[model samples]
Target: MRSLARCCARNERRRHDCKEYRRAVVTYYLGIDAGGSHCRCRLVDSDRQVIGQGESGPANARIGVEALKATLMFACNQAIAQAGLSEGDVARIDAGFGIAGIGRPGIKEQLAQLDFPFRSVRYETDAFIANLGAHQGADGAILVIGTGSIAHVRVDGRSFSIGGYGFPISDEGSGAALGLSAMRHALRALDGRTKPTPLSAAVTGRFDHDTTLAVAWMDQATPRDYASFAPLVMDYADAGDSIARSIVEDAALHVERFIEAVFERGAPRCALAGGLSHRMRPWLRQKTVERLVEPLGDPLDGALLLAGSP
Candidate 1:
């Protein structure tokens, strides 16, 4: 009986030690979704349980590497603090980032050189992560119309994309695009080249009807700056303003084209995502509207998947 008791005690000790070992070896992951307007971070444990969340300002790569880094770190530090973790724990965390402008030339290379506090780090375009989250890593496509626009599809382990070149060049269905259209119409109205509708008058009113002031604002405007006008355009459209309706309808046509292109690439499913998606949906053709699916997850979830968190 004494020998049996000893064996049972030893076995219990072994089990306790094993539990401690497992706890000590558990990993943590940080997922970041950085866009033209905001930076968001999520922290999770190895079991895929949320530890904390944080958000900060824009982290667009075009904003300059130092500023981008500052934005990212500010959000990350908040998440770490919320998780009750110290800065030292950063060295043990794996990180995944889905950032706007990452696909631009030299941006990825510049980011790769940063000394981030993580055990591992990976980067991908925001559109790619949105698609991954939308479909839960399954084969699918996503059309993102936010401050910028992009179409991305993944099929059979391969990825293809359309649009999202950037503001002024591409992003056809984006908020910035709508704002740009409004600005042009407003300018035309100011020059007496077009009839000044409520939309045009409202746009011009922002500059106090001064074309010179409008031009000066344009000279310093970034995509986010232009996107600020999108809500006003959308509001005017809903109120039956002809110029606003025209601008929205034109942008919707671009959205339709992007959706068709994604389907043409053999994506079995497609989702419309981003801040402007909800507003844009009501403007889409019925047939196009019927085809979009609700996303299964969000970009932060996709970023976590990229981090290889269990």
Candidate 2:
């Protein structure tokens, strides 16, 4: 009886060892969706099963290579730790990144020059990954309205984009643009050029209603700083603030135009994506709203797909 029990115990031990060996041999993939507002990291095994996820602050390429690298590493490390792995495992993991501002001149080259700790790495624009994830790499269009906004389409094996040229000059209908408009309205109210509403008053109140202080803040403000006011504008608009409503309406008009252009370019379906997509939807035209479809997946899924791509 004792001999039979020992044989059964040894068989169970072998099975456990085999299971651990199989797990150890499985390849890991890491996907990163780094955007203007935040960076997300996802770790998956060869079977595409998610093991861990991590998030960090903005990782826009415009922030510079070193800073972007640091942000990516922090998120990756967090994901690794969550998966019961260590930093050394990064070298064995394949990585894919969809990063904002990657289309700017020299940015891609700059990123390639960095010594990333991955078995291999693939890079694409954040919009690209979002579109890819939305349609599962099928032909479709996506308009991402986060801190910045851009429209991307994939049709007939060709890809194109509209807007997303960065803040101040481009990125129409973006959070930064909305905030900038709000700030301008607030300043105009202070100058008596426009009537004060709750929205403008709220904006000016942030600076104590002092024009000098507001100017100081603008002089040093980045796109993220301006974008911070977008939620406030949306809130006030929802509460029946006319000026805020106008601002959002105008922004939504631009978004609608982008969607129309995407369809005109031959995209069969479009997905509204990003942080502000929901807020902007109610303000868009019924025609535009009718054309929208739910995305099949998120940017992180696209990033993982890229990680396994040739």
Poorest 10 consecutive residues by lDDT, candidate 1:
83-92
Tens digits of lDDT, candidate 2, 205-275? 99999999999999999888999999999999999998999999899889999999999999999999999
lDDT per residue (tens digit) for residues 167-273 in model 1: 99999989999999999999999999999999899999999999999999999998998999999999999999999999999999999999999999899999998
Q: Which pairs of residues clash in candidate 2, taking residues 3 or more apart in a chain or in different chains?
A: none
Off by over 4 Å in 2: 86-88
lDDT at 67, model 1: 90
lDDT of 1 at 77: 91
- Poorest lDDT segment (10 consecutive residues) of candidate 2: 84-93
Please, what is the TM-score per model?
A: 0.92, 0.96
Superposed model 1: Cα runs more than 4 Å off: 1-23
